[model samples]
Target: MTTYFHTAAALCLAAGMASAQSADVPDNLDKLSNFQSTGVTEFTFIEQDGRYAEGIKRTLERITLPDGFKIELYAVVPDARHMAVGPQGIVTFVGTRKDKVWAVTDRNKDRVADEVKDFAPSLTFSIPNGPCFSPDGFLYIAEQNRVLLFPAAEFFYESPDVAAFNLVAKGDLVPPEEESFNHTARVCKIGPDGKIYISLGQPFNVAPADKLDLYNEWGIGGMIRMNTDGTGREVYTYGIRNSVGHDFHPVTGELWFTDNQVDGMGDDIPPGELNRQTEMGQNFGHPWFGGGTVRTNEYKGEEVPVEVVHPVVDMVAHAADLGMSFYTGNMFPEKYKNAIFSAQHGSWNRTTPVGARVMVTYVDAEGNATSEPFAEGWIDENDEYLGRPVDVAQLRDGSILVSDDLAGALYRISYGE
Candidate 1:
C-alpha cells in the first residue's frame, strides 16, 4: 500500500494483497476489496443495443438545440446524477442518488458508450452522488457520510474489485445524525489550486438560527476544500441552502456554483442562484435571502449579521439548476468560448414545468453574466417530464455530456454532428 491509501482514520483488519482493508471498511467489503469474490459476480449491466436505448434515442429527436448542435444518446445510466470525465479519457465515472456508481467506457472512440456497469461493486456506498477526478487521474467519490478515493480509476475500473481507500472515513463527511436523503447529493471538483472542493447541503428548508453556528462549524450549508489526502479541511464558502453543482473557473480560478433556494415560497418568489466566490469565507445569503436579493420568510425581520454576496446570475424561480461546467471545448463557435453550460433539472411542484433542459451562461469582461436556454424539449405537451437533467460534463474530445436521472441516460451534445 502506498502513502496515498495511508490515513490515520482508516485502521484496517483484513484485506486482499492490494485491497484497502480498514476499520472503516465492513466485513463484507473485506471480501470485495480483496478481489476474493464473495459469490457476488453477477453485475447489473445496462443494455447498450436494445429497444430501451432506441427509445432514449427517439426522445433525443424531440430535443431542440441551437443551430449546428445536436444531442444523441451516449449511454443508458440509471439515476445518473453527477459525472466526472477521467483525465485519461479512458472511462467516465458517473454517480447516482442511490447506492451505485457506474463506469461507462467507449473503447471504439465512437463517442457512444460500449459498456456500462457498476463501479467497485465490492465496496458499499450510500448516496455516492459526486465523482470528480484529480488532474493526475485519481477518482474521489463524495458519499453521504464518507469520501472514498480510487487511484487510476480510469485504468483500474475494468476489474470488479479495484484498489480503494478512504479519503474521509465513514460518518466523517458529515455527522451521521445530520444525514438526510433529500438535498444530500454532493458535487465535487478539483480546483485550480490542486485541492478537492466538495459541497455540503444543509438538510432543511431553512436552517434554524440555533443550528447556524453548528452548520457553520461543520460546513453543512457551505462548500469545503481539502488536500487530496484529506487534510487541511476548511469551510471555503458559506450561506447556501443546497448547492448540487459547482466548478472552478479555468481562467480566474474562482469557484462558481448553483444553489437551490427555499421551497414553499410560491412558484416565483426567490429565483435560483448561480454564485461566484472570489475569495474564501464569502457568505451567500441562505436563511436570510432565499435566493437572489429576496429574503426568506423565516428571517424576514432579523438583521443579517454576515456580509452576503448576492448571486452573479439569478435564474428562473423553481427551475432547479443543478450541475454546470465552463465550455473550453473547440467543437463550438467562438461565441461559446468560456461560456458556462448548465442543466435545469426542472421543478418538482411548479404550476407549469419550467426547466428540464440545458442552459448557457456567458460572463462578460466586466464580470456580468447572463443565461439562456441551450437545449430544450425534455418536457412534453402534457407537462410531464421525459428526462430530468442533472450534471454537465465536457469530454476530452471537445463535445459535452449531459446526465439525466429521470431518463437514466447520458446524452452527448456536439456541434455539426
Candidate 2:
C-alpha cells in the first residue's frame, strides 16, 4: 500500500498536471477511467484554514452524546456514504454517491486515520454507494447498475489493480430503458443465510400504474437475495420506494431496513420508516401508504394487492433515513447492546431541516421496539446543517464510525471517554 506522505506529493503533482490538460478529456465512462487512472490519489482534502477548523471544533463541542461517550474527527473523506470495515481490521472501505470509494487506515492504532486514499483507483465507479464484505474477505460493491466482487479485497486493495469479477454485469441490475437517476442509490449486505442481499430503489416517486407490473417483475422496488456467485436470484421483499440501508438481526437473523417516504406531501404528515421483515416475500407499503398507514395522493383509491407491513418505528417526516447497522459490540454500555444505530441524512425539501443525527432503536426480547435520539446537534440553532450523517458502521474495537457527506468527513464515536 502507498504510504501517506508518498501519496500526498504524487497526488498534488498529478492534480496540477490534470489541470493543464483539461482540454483533451475523453467522453463518458472512458473519460472517468482516464481521470481516475491518473496518479491523483487524493481527490479531496479537509479544510485546514483557521476559520474552517475553528468552526468544526465549535460544532464538535456542541454535539451531545450519552454519558461517558465522546466523538472525534476520524478522517477527511469526500462524499463518504456507506462503509465496510475490513476483516483484518486494518482498513475501512467507504463508498460514495459519486464516482469514488475511499480506503482509510489507522496505522498506529490511535483510532485516528493516518491516511485516506482512493480505493481501486484504476477503475471507474458509477455511484458505488454500497460495499459489503463476507466473512472470508470477499468484498462486493453495489454500483448504480452492476455488482462487482473482489476476492481477498482486504489484502489486495493496496495495489493499483485489484482482481475483480462482475457478479451482476452492467445493464443487468435493472432494465436499461427503465433506469432513472432518481433514487438510484443501491445498498447491499450479507445475510445470515450467507446470501448477498441487495436493495433496488425504484426511480419514480410513486411508480406509475403502467410501470408497476414491470417494476415488480424486475425486482426494481424490492430487495433481492442471491448466492455469493450471483446465482439463485429471487426477490426477498417488495413494495419499497427507496431503501438505502438494511442489516440482518444478530440473533433472530431477520432483515431490518430504513425507507425514505414519498415527498411532495407536507413537511410533517407522512413519516419515514424503519421496517422489519421476518419472512421472504414480505411487502412494505410504498405507493398505497406513504410511510405508516397514511394513504398517498396518487394511489389513495387503488386496491392493495399484498399485505402492507408497518414499520418497527416511525421517524419524523422528511428525515431521509438512509443507512443503519445493529450494535453488537461490547464497547458501549449494556443498554446499547443489540440496539440499532441508524442515520437520518436530513431533509432537503422541508422548510426547517430535521434529522442530521444518529438514532438508536431498542428492541426487547418480545420484538417490541422503541427509538430515540442517540446523537444530536448536527442541525444548528439557525436550522443549517453543520454535518449530515449518512451511514453507521462499527469498527473492530467497538467504536462506531459515522460518515458525513455534507462535511466530507468521518467521525468516530466511542464510549467510556
Q: How big is the RMSD of model 1?
A: 7.4
lDDT of 1 by residue, 132-176 (tens): 999999999999988888887899787767777788888888888
Which residue pairs show backbone clashes in model 1?
A: 11-23, 12-22
lDDT, candidate 2, 1-417, per-residue tens: 333222335445544654564445332333332333434343333332334434555677888998899998887776689999998998898998876788888889999887777777656677899999998888999999988887877886676556667889878999999877899889999999999999999998887878878888878889999999999998899999999999988999989999999899898969999999989988898779888888899989889888989998899999999999999999999998889999999999998899999999998886778999989999988999999999999999899999998876788999986
Each candidate: what lDDT?
A: 0.87, 0.84
* Candidate maximizing TM-score: 1
Give the number of colliding residue pairs in candidate 1. Answer: 2
Native-to-model Cα distance after best TM-score fit, residue 302 in candidate 1, in Å: 0.4
List TM-score per model, in order: 0.92, 0.90
